[model samples]
Structures are given as structure tokens and as C-alpha cells.
Target chain A: MKTLIAIKEQYHTWVHEAFPAMHPLLLPLCNKPFIEYLIDFAILAGSREVRLLSDGQLTEVEEHCGTGSRWGIELSYANLHPADDQQQLLDKNRKFCGGGRTMILTGYNFISYNKQKSYLDLATIATDTPIASCPGGTITLKGPPESGASEKSPLAPFSITPLDSVQSYFRISMETLQTGSSRYVLPGYGSEPDCSIGKNVIISKTAQIRKPVSIGDNVQILPKTIIGPSAIIGSNVVIDNGCSVSGSIIIDNTYIGENLEIDMRIAAGNTLIDPTSGVSLTMEDPHLLVGIKTWATTAILKRKTIHALAATILLVLQFIPFILLFPLLKLQGKWKDDPYMQETGLAGALAVAISLDRFPLLLKVITGKLDIIGSSSRSTCAGKHSYPDSGPLSRLAVFSYAEAEDWPVNGSDAAIVERFHAVHSTPIKDIGMTIKALINRLTKGR
Target chain B: MAFRLDTLNGITVGIAELNGRLVAENSTILQKTCSDWQQKTPFLVFDCSNLDFIDSSGLGTIVGCLRKALEKNGDIKLAGLNAKVAMVFELTKAKKLFSIFSNAGEAAASFAASPVSSKTQ
Candidate 1:
């Protein structure tokens, strides 16, 4: 049987409000996207072809489910209008429906079905009306029923609940967690009851875990911390020292700070949310709650190496010019030397014209102390320094990216430009930026 | 927020009715009102049936009122908590700190039944 799943954006508006960064259908329930459960159900009900129709953008869902080859089914997506009715939907997908028995699943509701139960018989069940429904959506069957369908026994009742609010979302998550893998095909692995753990998990010896918990990959549970009895910790999470997390869902890439207590809540990055109350707190102190860095080390290393090589070449080209101009400029008082500070303003302009001021900074780049083109150096003072939005990756460079792009040399706007390049610029792109910086310096004489 | 005082079985219970949204801007009013209510009668019942939404500041204010009542050797019970308001209490583990009931009368009656009230009288 072919399956048609129609999900409207307005149906899950509450989810969008709560987790603005996540697509409503892609919201993770027990470490699995909500849409996957619907797909799993469709496949189990003897669906070979599944088409998803959404009034909202389906690019993320399409990219994720793609062809559904992993589940050995054909998956497709189509656009739907907000005002589209059942007949209009049927008319639009007439080619895919193709006179075959089609199951229509609509709304953003949670379908309660046991994996152990055989729902393949749903294909043979003759029904013109909706089989089951909640306020959020409905399940309807179209086309002719299979011939020689057994009339022996009754099928198990189908149930679905509208996930209209955070309370319902939280309740459903807890329900799925409590049921474990026996009832649903959940992500992660656990041979034992109520304990599903993913790969590369690091639990400190001093930390305690009470079961009925699900933990995802690359999680770090620090010393003196206690997790679970009823907790779901998503992948790439760091639960810091002396913390206790119980009856909470710590979403992926979140860092829970030291000596904190998180109970019956949901935490994503610096946002600590009380799901029941719809109350949320954005922690200002990064030490209390923050987002864990997830950039690949190999990529950073490659960029740094390319920057260093470029700095080395620039240093060699400027060596003779520095030797010839330094003594003349200093004797004429056009240059002033300070061990801790580099030349700036008129002296800085003369040094750049001769390419002398950047000489010492280029040498520092080869030592891995700086980059060839990046953000300006922030003070090393303990509490007064500021960093770019790209975090540690936005290192100080011999020639600032602001100078290359001809933006203001310093301040918040320059930091933004540096951060944008730090996150997105490639090694080859850095070489281009280096050329731009040299041209800008020669033209501006600074 | 509006408050009404009533005597149930000789125990004065202050009922604070919270309506609409209890968020940062208006949460202070509830806190101040609760403080004044505590002085008149230590037993308090927060009726939140009409409340639709609440943020962290509002939750904190309610917790603060509970603390004030406890300091006076009195207690705060919550009643008529809608699903949304009840969810906030449950998530913060604040539900464990109070005697919750379906309505104000039930909550007020419980205060009268408790042995601490008889002893204080």
C-alpha cells in the first residue's frame, strides 16, 4: 500500500515557538526525528511507496529521508496549499495514488502503535471513513480494499494524540522513553531494559547513572554527577562536574555547567526551558550553560598550515625592504619602536608602505602564534578581552580580515566579518584574502 | 492578580486569582500582592484556572511567595491550576513543595483539617 502523509505548518506552531532552530517535523523525540516514526509506521503497515505533502518547506525532510532506501521503501515529497482539502489533495497526487490502495496520514499527531503488532492488515481493511483521528489530524484510507481479505478476527484499535502544546510534547517524550524499545523501534542500543546508550560515551567513575535512561553518542558525564532514572541525554552533550540531571531532556550539543540541578526540564544550548510551564531562561553566564564546540580539528589544522605557509612567503619578500627602510625611518623619527606594541598611524603608514611593520607579525605566524589574515588581536587582560562570534577559531592575524575587506579596522562590525570568514572561508579562499590585504595595505599605505 | 480572603472552618485562607499571562513585566505585582496577603493570613491558595501562560520570572515569584508564607509558620497551597500552569510547577519540581488541589474550596479545607492550624490556634 502507498502512504500519503500531509503535515501542515500551522498544526505544529507551538513546536516552532519552543524550538525555533528546529523544523517541527524534525524535532527529536528520544533522539529520533518525529517524522521518522511516521515513516516507520507506514513501512510496517505494508507501504512500499510513501509521499510526504507539506504546506511548509520540505527541503530538510527530503534531504533526511531521501528515496527511503535504508528502509527499503520509496519516499517522495510534494507541495500542498494551506487550504487544500481531501479531494484537492487526492486530485493533486492522482499520478502517485494510481488506483492503488492509499493510506492518508495527516496532522502533527503522535500515533501509538506497537512494533510487535502486525499492522499490515490495515491495507486489506475496507474503510471509506477515517480509521482514527484527533483534533490535530486524521488517518484515512482511499481506493479499493484487497480481495480475499480475512473476516476471521478484529484488528487492534488505532490511537493518535494531537501534539499541540509543550505539555503534550513533554508527555509524549516521557511516554516513549518509559515504554523503551519493546514498543517502538528507537535509536541507540540497549539489550537491557530502560537503558539505551550510544557510542563514544564517557562517564566519569565518580558519576552515577540510575537506569531508565537513554544517552546518545560522544556524551561526557563528569565527576560527582548523577543522571537519570528518567533522563534523555542527546549526542555531543557535556554534563559538567557535580551536576544532577533527572527527568530532563538535554538536547544535542548542549553544555550543562558545574554544580547545577536540572530536573524535569529541557535544555538546548544556553536556553533552559521548563516544558510544563512554557517558561524558559536564557543563561547569560556561559560557565552556567553554553553550546559545546563541534568543529573538526583536521579542518582547523589545514587552514592554519595554509595560513602559516602564506605568512612565510610574505616574510621572505619583505625582509630586504625592512632592512633598507627601518634605519632611515627611525633616524628621521618617522618610526618609533615599542617592544609590546606595533607601529600605527603615520609611522604605521610608512612601515606598511615599505612592508616593515607586518615583518615581525609574519614571523609570529610561522610559530603558530597568529594567522596571515584574520581578526585583530584582543588584549590578553584577564577580564577585559572580547572574542569574535566564531569563538577560538577567530584568532589574531598578521593582517586583519577587516583590512583585506576594507572594512573599519576595529570594533564589532569588523569582528562580524572576521567571524563570518573564520567559519566559512577555505584554505584557497584565505590565499585570495591575503592578496586582497596586501593590495589594500599598498594602496592605503597602511 | 486579585486576592479574596475567606474563613474556612475558622482558618483564614487568602485566595489570589491569577488571570491571563504571568510573565516578567507583571510578575512583580503578584509577588508584592502575595507579600501583603501573607501578613493578613499566612495560609494562601493561588487559583490559576484562568492563567494561560507563565515564564521563569512568574514561576520565581510564586516560589518566593511560598517561602514568605513558610517563614511565618504558615503554608501555601495551589488550587485550580490549569494544565499549562500545573506543567510549570511540575517541571520546576515546585509541585512537590505545595499541597495541590482541583479547586480553591478543596485547598482551603485541607488547611483547616491539618493539625498545625489547631495547635497554632
Candidate 2:
């Protein structure tokens, strides 16, 4: 059987306001991302393939999910139109659905299901009608029901709850913690029940830990700190000395200061939230609370530095050749003063070979305005060009990825190749790719 | 920031109305003014209705003011904090340090009601 999971941006818009830094699908519930729960459910239902459909950007989801080989299932992603109906969805994914029984899971809802329970019976449900549904979402089986075993059968036990607000999210997380690994496969390690801990944890010997707690990776419980009878601590968290955290969630990259007593609150970085009222507060004091910024910004800085260095080298290398050939080419009428330049003769070929045309843009790289290698724009027609300026794949750069890979791409195919590398390439890899781009340009010039 | 003294039920309370963003650039302004305000009357009510944003420095100044007021047997109560400002207080666990009221009038009057108890021990 196959499963098609559809989620619209409209349903998960609350995520933007509450947790602006987090993607809704990646929203953690009891230290497990929300999407994994859905995927697990699909796997439990004996699905060999699952296709994730969303109207929103799914790059982060794709990065997390990959090809689903880890789960031993074929996973794919596709865009969804906001106005697409169920029939349209089936029509768009006709090849994926095929003639086999397909399960359709839609909406931004939490599926309450047990991993131990046999959900293979889910295939016996009637086609095109919701077997189980709530105000949040529905689970429907498509195609003929299990090769004509029976026209209908009762659904395997499950329920869906709407994750519409912070309160619901808190409740669901707490609920999941209380339920533990019995109902779902939560990510953690615990020798005993109702207590899950992740890697690189430093719990102070003097610190106290109560049952029914989920602690994620790289967490530190300082001296005399007391961690919950019901607490969900995310990764890279620090509970300072004499602090007591119970019935609360300390999200990733957060620090709780000394002697602070957090009861039934959600502390995410500098933001503290009252779950019952959905009121969030941004803490103005760093000593008491703050966000632990790890390597992401540092990584960006490092990449920028590398790109700038590479661009600077290119700028210096082309300095003399550009001075020698550029004005000569202009004198010969082969080089234009404007952005659009054509090199047809020896001057043109030498200028192109030395990458003299990219001198102006290399400055942008040095100024940290553009990448050294990224998606390159081209004139598709008269004063018309196509290049991604936004989204995850968009990049402004001196050298194009298509040129780097030396792909014989034309029109839209060039866009496809550049887009692929924009997301996948790293700074060091981009340097190699940039060299390839330069080599390809020199060869093409000859 | 603007400051004025008001006699609330026989207690002289200074009400400091913080305006706009209290970020790093102007946090020192508040810190300097807090010392001057304490000379007149250490008991203060920080009216934060007009405060749109605050950073760690701004919050640190407030905490410093509270500490100074406490040393002189005075108290700093907060009032009229909007949602955004209130969030900052809660995130830093600073809300636990001060007695908050909906308005300056209520916060200042509380000083008169039990001035001795208002002092953080």
C-alpha cells in the first residue's frame, strides 16, 4: 500500500507566529519531530511508498526525510496547489497511487496511534470514505479495499487532534511524554520507563531527576538543579544551579538561569510562554535566560569568508589581463561598456579565458553580497532573464553551478542544474566547483 | 524615558515612563537617570505601556535599578507592561522579582499600603 500525506500552509500558519524560527513539520513534540509521527504511522500501515504533499516550501522537510531509505520506504515530495481537491490530488499523483490501496492523510493534526498495534487492518476499510476523522484531519483509504475481502471493516484504533495553538501543542507534548514509548517510538534512551535521555548529556551529580521526563542531546543540568516529574528538555539546553524545572518544556538552544523555578512553562531561547493562555514573553536579561546560538551563523560566516577569499584571488588574477585586454577589446568594438559584453576575436577570447568579464561581480563576493559560485542568470530574450531570487534554492553569485558541473544545459535545464547545486553544495565543495567553472569557461573560450 | 514624582496615599513614589525601544543605545540613559531618580525617591513604578521593544541591556538596567532601590530599603514595581514587554520579563524570570500592576497608580499606591514589605529582603 501507498500513502499520500498532504498538508497546506494555511493549516500550519500558526507556527509562524508562535515559533517563527521553526518549520511546522519539524515542530518537536516530546522531542520528536511532528512529521516523523505521520511517517511512522504510514509505515505501520504497511505502506511501501509515501509521498509528502504540501503547498508550502518543503526543502527543510526534504532535508530531514531524505529518500526515506532509513525507514525502508520510498519517499518522495511534490508541490500541492492551494485549490487542489482530493480528485486533483489523486490525479496529480496518479503514478504514485497506482491501482493499489492508498492511504490519504491530510491536515496539520497529531495522529494518536500505537506502534505495537496491527494497523494492517487499515487496508480493509472502504475506499474514498474517511475511516477515522476529527475536526483536525482525516484518514481515508483509496482504491478497491484489499482485493475484495469485504466491502467494509472497522478501522484500527487511532485519533487525530488539531495542533492549532500553543496550548494544544503543549498538551500533546505532555500527553506524548506520559504515554512514553508504549504508544509511539519516541527518540531517546532510557533504562527505565517514562525517562528518555539523549547523547552528550551532563547531569550534575547533585542534580535531581524525576520520572516522566524527556531530555534531548547536549543538555546540561547544573548543580542542585531539579528536572521534572513532567519536563521535555530539547537539545543544547542548560538549567543553571539551584533551578527547578517541572511540568515545562525548555526548547533547543535555551538557557535557564540560576535559582529560576520554571513550572508548567515553555521556555524557548529568550522567549518564555504560558501554555494555558498562549502568552509568550521575550526575556530581556541574558543572565537569567538567552538563546545559545551554535555553529549556524559561524558556518555562514566561514562560507562567506571562503567565498570572499576565492573571489579576491580571482579578482587579483584577472586584474592585469583585464587591464590589458578590456580597453583593447573596447577599442576594437568587440567589448561594450555596458553589462552585455561580446568577445569574438583574440581580445575577446583572452578576456573570456582570464574571466575578465566577472571582475565587477567579484567585488560583490568580497563585500559578502554574493556567493563565489551559485545560480547564474542568463538573458532568455530581449531584456528578459530568469533566475531564482528567493526560496531555498535562490542565490546571487559570480560563477554558476551549471558552469561548474559543465552541464550542457539549455533554457530551463540550466535552472534545474543550478537549483540542485545551490542547496547541495558546501563552501569547500563550492571552491572545487568554482575552479571547474573557471576551467570550463577557459575551455569554452578556446 | 520620562520621570515624575507623585504622592500616593502619603508615600512619595517616582513613576518613570519608558518610551519606544530600550535597547543598547539608550540603556545607559536609563541607568544614569535611575541614579538621579533614586536620589529624589527610591520607590519607583516603571510604566512600560509605551515601551515597544527591549534588549538584554535594557532589561539589565531595570534589574540594576531594582537592586539599587532594594539596598536603600526602596522598591521598584512595574506597571502597564504591554504583551511584548511582559514577555521579556517572564523569559528572564524578572517578573518574579517585582510586584506588577496594570497601571502606575495601582503600583504607586501599593507602596503606601505596605512600604516596609515592599522592600526586597
Candidate 3:
């Protein structure tokens, strides 16, 4: 069976007002994208192919779900007109429909379904009408029912709630959290009931976490802080010392201040919201409550000064070597002037033997255009070497921090390591990293 | 920025109706007005039904007003806080510091029923 998930722009109008930064389809319910739940349901209903139709741009959704090969289902996307009805939609997507039994999920609604329950019976139901519906949208079955299916037993009932308001969004999230993994396929891992935590979570010894809580990856719970009873802390969040958080959802990239109490609220960045009342307040003072700034610029001037001095010293040491080796390498067809492939010469035996290739990048460090030890340099031109979503901490450097730590020199893991050190490392620490990176480069014969 | 002073049941209660937003630019006005209102009566009620928004500065100003009321053996209570304004109070934990009522009249009436040496005093 094929699934056609059509979500109209009007269905998610409230999401744009509540969370301007988040795409309605990408909204996280329990640290998982809302669309993933629909996809899971589609798979359970025996869908081999899924097509997402939306009036709004589906670029982010396409990037996130990709071809849906991860779920062993072929995923496709199409644009829909706001005025298009059910018949027009079917006519437009006739090629995708292929005249087979199709399940059309039309709305931005939360479908309540237990993962343990097999929805394969949807294929056997002989109905061309809407199987379920709410104010926001409806779920309807199209095409003829399969033959040799049991007609005696009735189909199992399914429920869906319209995600029309902030209160409903909050209520659904809390409901899912309360339900835990028993009814839904939620993210995170837990051995006990009602406690799921993700990777790289740092919990202080004095911090207390009660049951019925869900915490995402890279979360830091400082000393004397209490989390739980009913709490959801998203990824890259930091709950400071002497704070108590109960019955609240702290979104990603947020910093909860010290000695504070967060109860029955939803905090996203600087905005604190009361779910019950649908009230929101944007905090002005960063110390009291603020978004966690990703980059570390506290001692940038000091780091630049140290890097310049180190670069100058290295320039003096390598000046004569570079002058002698460059001409020889150029004559031997071993030297290239490509900016993106600066490290290509380093791969050569002659360049590695005398460390002549690193001399040019030291000039960049001296000019303050690059860090002595940070993230690897990428080209400004469009290509695979260009940095995607160049975050604040992703600075071009002569020597990468990943190399200093002997981690993978490329990919997401390397970027994470670089960002971690960039935010935590001092000028003095950077010097040690530079030395380590230099040693690693020389010892590795590249 | 101004208060509507009224005496209900032998207790002089100052009612301040805040409208629109109480942000950093005009938060000082509320602080000044509440300080002056403290001199006239010990019991104060901030009617916030019309208030739509509040930032951290506005929250601090309210906390300061409560402190001023406390110094004069007086008390400041909150009333008719809309969902948005009430959320700011809850987030900062300022809701715990004062007695909250459903309306200005209720808040004023409660001041008269309570003894002078009650929790606020």
C-alpha cells in the first residue's frame, strides 16, 4: 500500500505563530520530528511508498527524511495548491497513486496509535470514505479493497487530535511523555520505566533526576539541580546549578539560569511560555534566562595575539627551508597552488620530510585570517570542500583541533570535537594543541 | 504608570491597572508609581488583566515594588494577571512572593479582611 500524506499550510498556521524558527512538520514531540511518527504509522499500515504533499516548501523535510531508505520505504515530495481538493489531488498524483489502495493522511494532526498494534488491517477495510478526521484534516482510504480479506471482524478504531493551538501542542507532548515508550516509538534509551536519556549527557553528582523524564543528547545538568517527575530537556541544553525543573519542556540550545525554578512551562531559547495559559514572555536579561551562544569569544584578542606570535616564530624558522624546497618541488611537479587543496603538498614525501608545505598557512595565522588550531579550512567556492552551515565555532585553521586530539579529520564527529575545544580551550591550551597537531602531522608522514 | 486609589472596608487599597506592555523602556514608571502608592496605603493590588507582555526588566520592577511595600509595613498583591503576564511571573518565580487574586475588587477586599500583622505585614 502507498501513503499520501498531505498537510496544508492552514493546518499548521498556529505553529508558525508559536515557533517561528521551527518548520511545522519538523516540530519535535518527544525529541523526534512529528513527521517521523506519521512515517512510522504509514510503515505499520503496510505502506511501501510514501509521498508528502504540502503547500509550504518541503526542502527541510526532504533534507531530513531523504529518500526514506532508512525506513526501507521510498519517499517522494510534491507541491499542492491551497485550493486543491481531494479529486484534484488524486488527479495530479495519478502516477504516484498507480490505482492501488492508497491511504491519504491529510492534516497536521497527532495520530494516536500503539506501536504494538498492527495496522495492516487498514488494507483489508472496504471503505472509500474517511477512516478518521478532525477539524484540521482527515484520513481517507481510496481505491478498491483487496480480495480474500476477512469481512466478519470490524476494523480497529484510530484517533487523531488537531494541532491547532499552542495548548494542544503542549498537551500532546505531555501526553506522549506520560505514555512513555509503551504506546509510541519515542527517541532515547531507558532500562527502567519512564526515564529515557540520549548520548553524551553530563549529569553532576549532586544533580537529582526523578522518574518519568526524557532528556536529549549533549545535555548538561549542573550540581544541585533537580530534573523531572514530568520534564523534557532537548539536545545541547544546559541547566545551571541550584535549579529545579519539573513538569517543563526545555527546548534545544537553551540555557536555564542558576537558582531558578521552572515548573509546568515550556522554555525555548529566551522565550518562556506557560502551556496552560498560552502565555509567552521573551526574557531581556541574558543572566536570568537566555539562549546558549554557541561560539566562545571571551578571549579572542588574547588567542589572536598568541597565534600571531607563534606564526611569526614559525615563519622565521621555516623561511629558509620553504625558499629552498618550494622551487625544487615546483620543478619536480609536486607543488600545486590550489587554495582548497592546501594540504595536498603535505601528502608528498619531500614536503613532509622538511615540513615546508605548512609555511604558507602560518602566514594566514599571522594575518589573523585563520586560527593556529581550530576547525579544518574549507573553500569559499561551492563544492564538497565547502563548509555547510558554517556555525560560529567552525573557524578555518592551519592546524585542526581534531588532529591534535587524534580524532577523525573530517565528517560530523570531527566538527563536534572542534566545536567542543573551540568553546573550552584557552590561548595557552591552543598552543599545546598546535604542538600536538604538529607532532601528529610529522609522525604520520603527512 | 498611574494608580486608581480606593478605600474598601476600612482598608486603603491602591489599584494600578497596567495596559499594553510593561517592558524595559517604561518599567521604571511602574516602579516610581508603585513607590508613591506605597506611601498612601500599605495594601496594593496590581490589576494586570490588560497587560499583554512583560520582559525581565518589568519583572524586576515589580519585585522592587513588593520590596518597597514590605519596608513600609505594607503589602502588594497581584490581580487579574493575563496569561502572558502571569507566565513571566511564574518563570521568574515571582508568583510565590505575593498574594494573587482573580480581580482588583477581590484583592482589595482580601486586604480588609486580613489582620495588619498577617503574612504580608
lDDT of 3 by residue, A205-285 (tens): 999999789999999999999999899998889999988899898887889987788998888878888788787777777
Query: Taking the true A–B contacts (Cα pairs closer than 8 Å), what share appears in each candidate?
Result: 0.00, 0.35, 0.80
lDDT by residue for model 2 (A275-354), tens: 98887777666877788877468778888999999998888888888888777887887876443357688778778776
| lDDT (10s digit) by residue, model 1, range A71-122 | 9999999989999987788889999999889999999999988888778888
TM-score of 1: 0.57
Give residue B25's error in model 1 in angstroms: 22
Count of backbone clashes, every candidate in sequence: 2, 3, 0
> Could you tell which candidate, 1 or 3, scores higher by lDDT?
3
- Residue A264 of candidate 1: its Cα lDDT? 85
Deviation from native of the Cα of residue A371 in model 1, angstroms: 19
Which residue pairs show backbone clashes in model 3?
none
Look at candidate 2 and give me any clashing residue pairs.
A281-B87, A282-B87, A282-B88
**TM-score for chain B of all predictions:** 0.90, 0.94, 0.91
C-alpha DockQ of every model: 0.05, 0.32, 0.44
Residue-level lDDT tens digits of model 1 in B2-95: 7899887887888888899888899899888888898899998888888877766787888898888888888888788876566556545567
Which has the greatest TM-score? 2
